[model samples]
Target: MSLYTFAKNLVAVILFPVFRIKIIGKENIPKEGPVIICSNHTSNFDPPVVGITSPRDIYFMAKGELFEKRFLGKLLLKIHAFPVKRGMKDRNALRRGLEILEEGYTLGLFPEGTRSKTGELGRPLAGAGFFALRSKATIVPCAIIGPYQPGKRLKVVYGKPMDMEKLRNSKASAQEAADAIMEEIKFLKENHSP
Candidate 1:
């Protein structure tokens, strides 16, 4: 197995005992093809939580700053993460994500751009929606809750894959599509079974 697959499975194995993860709607994810997994950013643990929960291999858009650490950067790259400049529309990073999608790989993204210190979903960025519309990839809305507390159950709910027909035609604005996706994520989180 590749380093990415090994690391992902390793992380999952490590978390399984410490965190009681109650996952819902896992079948919503596609069995094959390129997909965009979009979720809220609440903590550093969010990435690993989402990564471990999903059965498929997911390539993440890690912050460019993380790549500055040589050893950590190489490790991140090996685990299917590519660095992206934060707070701006980085075209090169976007192109790379699209290329991964074109190759039929799953891409994980946070539409909020950064972690929410306030524990609330921040303003959704347009990048995820833009890529979803451009690539015509299925968008999977995911909600993660209660991560970073090893004793508590960390919950993740994956909503049904959104076809985004209105979005596919470019008739809907990117911001509009993003808003819709974020709303769905919010819905799943609030309604998730305890």
Candidate 2:
């Protein structure tokens, strides 16, 4: 097995039970395809949590800052995470994201761009929609409810993939598309139980 999967599984085995992670709508994930896993960013743990709970291997677009650290950067890179420059267009990151999808790999991104210090949903950036529409990849909305307090029960609900074909055809702004995705996550938080 790949190092990332091995590490992810090991971590899940240890943490999933301790946290009592509740995963819902897992069957909604596609068996195989290029897709974007979109969710609100509440904590750094969100990435590994999603990685473990997902039915398939998923790569992530982490902030560029993480990659600047020597040891941490190597670790993250080994685990399938590449860096993206926040608050500005990072062409290199965008190209990498497109390349990942083109290779039919699942790409994970937080629409909010950065983690919410207060654990509240923040205004989403349009990066997720940009990548999704540009690649025409299915957008799977995920809701990670509650702060990532260790050993506390937390829920992750994956909503069915949104209709990207329709979204692609419509003349919607990037923000509008992002808003739609956020709406899906919010709906899951309110309606779905994990």
Candidate 3:
């Protein structure tokens, strides 16, 4: 296994039982090749929550501020997380994401940009759609539900790959594509609510 995969798996194994994570639709994840695993933002724990449950290495975009703590930042980098400045368009982060996709690796992106403290689905930013269009990669819509409480199962449902043909052909705005993806995620969230 790759070093990042090993580290992620190691951490996942340790936390799985502790968090009582119960993941569904894991098979929906493409076994290989470049793909974007788009998910909803809930709590600060969402990244690790989804990461630990994934069977493959899924690199995530963490905020640059998290990397400010030299020691913590180094550790995060080792585990396959690169920094992205929240709000402003960070070209460096976008470049790194593209590079990861070009290398045939999976990337995890939260369309909402930041965690939603309200637990409701929020507006999605266009970055995920932009990345998909730029890389010509498949977009896997995912919904994460339930509280990440100890002994309480945390659920994640992976939707089928989104149809990009419409977005590819028409003059549909990036935000429109993102909203459509978010709508699918919302449907999954409602259908799979615990």
lDDT of each: 0.87, 0.86, 0.85
- Assess candidate 2 and give its TM-score to the true structure: 0.93
lDDT of 2 by residue, 21-50 (tens): 999888888988898899877877889899
Task: Identify the runs in model 1 with alpha carbons over 4 angstroms from their true place.
Answer: none
lDDT of 1 at 20: 84
Which candidate number has the best TM-score? Answer: 1
Candidate 2 whole-model C-alpha lDDT, 0 to 1: 0.86
Which residue pairs of candidate 1 clash? none
Reference-based TM-score, model 3: 0.93
Ranking by lDDT: 1, 2, 3
Q: Once model 1 is optimally superposed onto the true structure by TM-score, how far is the C-alpha of residue 135 displaced, in angstroms?
A: 0.8
For candidate 1, lDDT tens digit of each residue in 1-194? 89977877898888877888888889999989999999988888788888888988899999999999999999999988999998778998999999999999899989998899987888899888788777868899999877567778888889999879967676887888888889988888788745
lDDT of 1: 0.87
After superposing candidate 3 on the true structure, give the runs of residues whose Cα lies further than 4 Å from its correct spot: 1-3
lDDT of 3 by residue, 1-194 (tens): 87677777787777788777777888888888888889999888788777877776788999899999999999889888999998798999999999999999989999999889889988999988778777867788889888868887778888888888887788677788888889889988999996
Better of 2 and 3 by TM-score: 2
The model with the greater lDDT, 1 or 2, is 1
TM-score of 1: 0.94
**Top candidate (lDDT):** 1
